[model samples]
Target: MSLFCHRIEVKSVQTAGIIIEYNPMHDGHLYLLEQVRAQLGADTAFVGVMSGNFVQRGDFALLRKHARARAAVESGVDLVLELPLPWAVASAERFARGGVEILSATGVVTHLAFGSECGDAAALERLAEALHCEAFPALLRRELERGDSFPAARQRALAQLTSPKDAALLSDPNNILGVEYCKALLQKKSAIRPLTVRRAGTPYHGTDLVGAQPSATLLRTLLRSGERDRALALMPPVVRRVYEAEEAAGRAPVFRENAERAMLARLRSMTEADFARLDEGREGLYRRLYETSRSACSIEALLDETKTRRYARTRLSRMVLWAYLGLEPAAFPRQVPYLRVLAANGRGRELLGRMRKCAGLPILTKPADVRELPPVAGELFRQEVRATDLYTLAYPDLFAAAGGTEWREGPVILP
Candidate 1:
């Protein structure tokens, strides 16, 4: 089809990169990779990314990162990098920063690619520019009081605050993330040119399969039901063994019903002063958090009870994660210095071996090497381990392999 075959050839990939969670490899992603390669050229190296135990949309990856990475390689990507938990758990801005930082750190990556509703590189950049302006935030607050979702409020705020040329974003979560990608690229002032492609056939939040590809949301629903046979059917053939092995060993992915209880308990146990240290819990957010926790039984309950015009659900999600990690509210890390490798394909494995010759940061393969990270990063990593331990509680099957057991150095790979 002309639509999926559209290609942008990269004459030479100074470096072409993508930040992603191939939660399950699907046709939409197959199209995305085709676009990335066409623009960057056939010779252009494809860099894949796989999210860890905790994922961006607030859950576990149905198949582990390594399995997912190998699947990307089989599908046509040349390399796969891990979006480490420290980054995988944070807010969009933080997630974007860590992602962009790692990609830019590759020293050769010249362009960053993403999917968007608008699909115009020039327009997204302008929105990013306005977002950084002085008047945007003030106007943003005014529109937010209309009780639109935080995304809608930001878009309307941008509409009134900026020129007529700037079309306000219409509350799309994928497009919103695309905006964050632009924001991070600009923030770092990196040389990586930003590119965007229009998403096709289905909306990101759609739950049905648009064609050969189903939304990650739909795939998650199947996995959540413990229907591996159904979910695995959509995945690349290479990932089947991994899932089957996990199933046989009674080690599989499952989302916990009460993963946030400890975080809620942390919030409940803390004084108002304690909540102030989290990233979004500043500016009296802790006050709301404390008040909400009094009547709520869960994190979603707290959000439902207290979310208002000024606070967004995304902010609340980050706040819960931040509190669980015991993050100092005031300080979020500026960059991810350690570009650790949680998983890789054969091509990616080669890249890791060669990166030491030209890279700026350490490329790690195991958790032990990450021990020297700064206080927040180290603590955050530890929280991820605890989160992993906590995550395993949801699946009785996983205990046979890595239960409440501590995480070890090597990756848990399926042969």
Candidate 2:
């Protein structure tokens, strides 16, 4: 049978893998989860590989990762595993790869489900295949040389190699990520089949709060602006409760600006060599960042000075964020080392039973469990510990921002 046919004809219980940041779980996110169950089966388990303290967008998550994971579990996900610091803040390609690797390592996940504008897995796969063609690289280089940003250049190259309709998929944020998911799955030769649900309500980056499904960007804006009720209205009831409880504890609505001075202090103290060490592009981007840091008083100013047509603002922001975290570009592992459980429901417990027997990577449900794993994995977990400590500094209340919470907190278990 064809792979597409085989993907949907799975005989065993389906466990759908979702890659998420869920900066805040809103109705749109809930709709995607429900859609997965609707299309796959009501009993289908959801295993989410979520970005931890930081997100792909190069900012602190609107809420702590554990709280967000709790919201996810309460909303319907069976298990939520962390995507880890390195991969969490990396480029889209690496972020997708890390999440995909985690789910593939689980061994129990039957499919990868995500929201996309196109919502056509086969189309994304075709685009993925086209990207892998030998001719695509030369075309990409041509576009890059024309002074386009990496994302813009890649889209331009794809447009050149494929029909406008196929290349147009890259224009939408969700479809771009969907294509990356397909590419990662193909590159790894993973057994997990790919699936997509058409995103409902608001567009990916939409800032308007008019629709049934407002974007997470809008929600974050509302939360940071002290509009709690407005933000809560967009989230699921369970998620709203979770945020309310977190806010009561002085832990909700963590923003990057809250910790700006600390990040600025860290960046200002770094040497040119240090910046160079963290440069991924090897194209003098970090050098520009270093020069900009000497005069730029705020993060926004630094980003503005460093950003150019060739370097997207988000790319520069990731660099600055990584610099503050002391994470060098070369330090990121190509594959996620371990599955760190962040939150789980009762169904997640059963899923864990199956994972113990079949998971390709080590699973860490407790902080102490790292001692039994390889040193590499242990060190990686330690980085996450440090990252959490820094993340807490962004909390509204410094009393709740104490270090060592990473080592103290285990998975959020729900009844």
- Cα lDDT tens digits for candidate 1, 155-252: 77777655544545546676678778888877777767887888875577777667676777777777777665787897656555656666676555
Model 1 ranges off by over 4 Å: 1-14, 141-149, 161-166, 225-229, 239-241, 258-273, 279-283, 295-302, 371-383, 401-415
Q: Relative to the unseen true structure, what is the C-alpha lDDT of residue 287 in candidate 1, on a scale of 0 to 100?
A: 76
Among these predictions, the greatest TM-score belongs to: 2
In candidate 2 the C-alpha lDDT for residue 64 amounts to 92
Task: Give per-model CA RMSD.
Answer: 5.0, 1.7
For candidate 2, give the lDDT of residue 384: 87
Superposed by TM-score, candidate 1 places the C-alpha of residue 132 at a distance from the truth, in angstroms, of: 2.6
lDDT of each: 0.66, 0.88
Instruction: For each of the candidates, give the backbone clash count.
Output: 13, 0
Deviation in Å, model 1, residue 187 alpha carbon? 2.0
Worst 10 residues of 2 by lDDT: 1-10
Which residue pairs in model 2 clash with each other?
Answer: none
